[model samples]
Target: MEKIATIGLDIAKSVFQVHGVDAAGEVVVRKRLSRARVIPFFAKLPRCLVGIEACSNSHHWARELIALGHDVRLMPAQYAKPYVKRGKNDAADAEAICEAVSALWLKKTRKVPLQPRKFLDFCWYQVNFLENNISISGG
Candidate 1:
């Protein structure tokens, strides 16, 4: 089996789809694992990078994967959308995320370190805007 340089996981309620690729952007692993098998499966592999769509449960899964020694990153769903080559499904979504994470354009933009408070400020602005809109317009 080719060593997995990165793996993209499509989280679901029961069956989780996983897609892995090698450094050359070749598919290495693709399967659907039951919720119970996620950690044990990842534990067997050598430490590798994992990309997961940023959803409500993603942080929880990310922590679990990190504990298994894999480097994990959360990517918003929209970032992974353009990579999907076919119809929507867990398998395709996993493949899309797998492709998105390894996109070369990312190399150009990842030069700067991301600050946590920038995310906080973005969230604050969103909430304040919503509150003010609701209060003044009564919509």
Candidate 2:
């Protein structure tokens, strides 16, 4: 079996599907894991980049994987859809995510000048802080 360099994970309510690929872009692994088995399965593998479709609990999974030393990215489902091959299924979705992730890593990035919005951001933070905090004793 080829050494897995990257993995695309398709998360669902109970069953989670994973599609892995080697550095040469060949499929290395394709398996279904239960919710209970996801962590143990990934724990045994060497550190690698993992791509996940952004959904309700994706952030939680990303955090867990990161804690295990895996670099994880949350990609929007719509972004991965165009790369899907034949049909729509968990496996297909995983494959699509892998393809999309591969493309993202292979592309060159350029530094762009960021627009300044200091005042706007400061006001937003101030408003949120005030709203979330309760004034107990004010002198």
Candidate 3:
């Protein structure tokens, strides 16, 4: 089996689609994983880059995957959208994310940093702080 070097994970409420490519750009893994099985599945693979579309819960997932030793990037959903090449579905979304991420890494003007846990956390904190201040001022 080809060793996976990068992966795109499309996560929904319960099911997740995964598309992986080897160093030569050959498909090495394509599967669906239940929410409960995601951690276990990735835990067994060697550390690799994982791409996820940025959403409300993507940060949490990124942190978890990072803990497992994988480099995770959260790309804007719109950025990945243009990469979809087939019918809309979890599988296609995953593939699109994979392609988008690969392209993102190649370019030098990335808006989001790699291993963005700290940046994300700081942003989250800022949002919360602003929300709290708004409520206090309004009440």
Question: lDDT of all the models against the reference?
Answer: 0.83, 0.82, 0.85
Model 3: CA > 4 A from native = 104-139
lDDT of 3 by residue, 1-139 (tens): 6789989999899999999999878899999999999999999999998889888888788888888889888887888888889899999999998888888454532333346668889889889989888443555
* TM-score, candidate number 2: 0.76
Task: Order the numbered candidates by TM-score, best leading.
Answer: 3, 2, 1
Which residue pairs in candidate 3 collide?
Answer: none
TM-score of each: 0.75, 0.76, 0.76
Higher-ranked by TM-score: 1 or 3: 3
lDDT by residue for model 2 over 105-139, one digit each (tens)? 63432211122257779778878878999444666
Residue-wise C-alpha lDDT for candidate 1, range 6-90, written one tens digit per residue: 8989999999999999888888999999999998899989998787888888878887887777877778788899999999999
Deviation from truth (RMSD, Å), model 2: 6.9
Off by over 4 Å in 2: 105-139
Determine which window of 10 residues in candidate 3 has minimal summed lDDT.
105-114
| The best candidate in terms of lDDT | 3
